[model samples]
Target: MSDTQAGQIGEDDHGHPAASKARLRLWLKLLKATKHVEAELRENLRTAFDTTLPRFDVMAALYRAESGLKMSELSSVLRVSNGNVTGIVDRLVDDGVLVRVPVDHDRRATTVRLTNAGREQFAAMAARHEAWIDEMLGGIDTSEIRAMTDQLERIASTNAKREG
Candidate 1:
């Protein structure tokens, strides 16, 4: 069974407790690893710019989309709801980090792009973000990082397809 299916009683070669316990352990291990990475990133973001990870994520997504992206696109990319995107966008817009422009094709549908100030801020923070990611994973060897990244990407893709 996969790690997530670790609910059934498991057995070892000696017939000791096996089934679900092993899966549970795997899940717990994954969770702990994820939590450690997240905490490190959270602290890095906090110290570097006094911003939360979610806000950074939203901004980074906008910055990456050269021509900007619609709220729907942002929502899908960020795996957040429209209301959540709206609030984040509103906050950023208030701070002049992003602008909402009416769509030429659909007036009601607005596209969000980083403003000059937003671009500048993102650029500054981006360098720091890259540094932090590198530092946090510095102990990981290059091959390991690549392998883990590929595995995680595959898992994420499967999950997205499953959940979406």
Candidate 2:
């Protein structure tokens, strides 16, 4: 079959168009699965913890950085714009869950970190978040999960290489 015909039906034996079609399908399935899990997590976070996914994400980043990260650094780590991080950090600061510390050398720059309370709160939320993921993926076998994780990691590495 010609490439266009092979692509249309995913029937090529030699593999360019067929592989492309298969990759497209895989991408769609991955996106759908991700969105499904994300939506569930978002709702769970909202109902159980009275928090939004973005807030949880910000906390998660800060939780990993013990010493704290500057506002710009946090924005970069989260792959979000500074303005977007600003509002969430502001709210978190107001709630006493995070604190802003002035940078010694840069008067205008400040680093943000989780407070003790924030750490405790995130530890609990993280435990539950893990459980939620486990429950959702309960049907998948451990070996299959590992294989898929490896494949995804490869894809990420390849994409990063391409970008760099």
Candidate 3:
């Protein structure tokens, strides 16, 4: 069947048109919701903290690690390239919120950790972030939220299995 026919109202030889269209609509809705939430978060971080999402993400990762993470490890955890992470790390280091310590027995490697001030700052941001998320998703009840979470997890698991 043609692409247009596949998206039309009736079934073709392959599968039910209604089911395919429903799945397509679901995918679009999911994408829209994700983008909307991400844009709101990016704006919130910028306006409230005068910080970008990338910087917040770097700090968050380090905050969770406590002892900090190596530069390469940070990049890996963030799923970003080393070059992309370097610029954010550089700015954080200059801001005195993050410190770089030379790794033992490794001349070319360094680990990044948040300073005392950085930890305090992140804690405030994290609390606010949680509230923001709660507020945005407040329309959904607890059970619905749990159900949706489980469904999304299933989708992720399916995709992981396919890829692996």
Candidate 4:
């Protein structure tokens, strides 16, 4: 393979180099891989579940911990703003897929949990989600996936530390 063809200096339609390229080619590949994964998940969630990705994401979190999640807690876990959570939750609540329950003794506090139907739907979609991730990782073997996961975790930890 040519030097530029070795995953660096990707050429454009006019045989020109990418306009704005990163020196770290590996990071660029990683970003592209992440976007691919997200796009696949979004399409799958839409077709298989007829649910928007973000709303499904919220429900998936609650489905994992069936007891419930506070609005603030879900916001933190989803890494989204409270207003965004409010919009998603409102739709879910209206559809009877989720319920907002009052905190046992603290009237002001509330938690969100999937309703029976929501739990059932989440269970089905969760299975498909797993399958989709597996299919997306088709070329890679088990060992490679583990190694990639470790490297990503390391990168994430470094960035988190840097931001902190």
Candidate 4 — which pairs collide?
none
Residue pairs with colliding backbones in model 2 are none
Model 2 residue 91 lDDT? 97
Least lDDT summed over 10 consecutive residues: which range in candidate 4?
Answer: 15-24
Q: After superposition, which runs of candidate 3 have C-alpha atoms over 4 Å from their true positions?
A: 1-16
lDDT of 4 at 115: 99
Model 3 scores worst on lDDT over the 10 consecutive residues at: 3-12
Ranking by TM-score: 2, 3, 4, 1
Question: Candidate 2: deviation at residue 55, Å?
Answer: 0.4
- Per-residue lDDT of candidate 4, residues 1-164 (tens digit): 86555656666676767633443577788889999999989988988778888988999899987899999999999999999999999999999999999998988889999999999988888899999988888999989989988988998999999999
* lDDT-sorted candidate list, best first: 2, 3, 4, 1
Superior candidate under lDDT, 2 versus 4: 2
**Cα RMSDs of all predictions?**
4.8, 4.3, 5.0, 5.0
Clashes of each: 7, 0, 0, 0
Model 4 / residue 156 / CA error / Å: 1.9
Cα lDDT for residue 62, candidate 2: 97
Superposed model 2: Cα runs more than 4 Å off: 1-16
What's the residue-level lDDT of 37 in candidate 2?
Answer: 100
Please say which candidate is ahead in TM-score: 1 or 2.
2
The TM-score leader among the candidates is 2
Best prediction by lDDT: 2
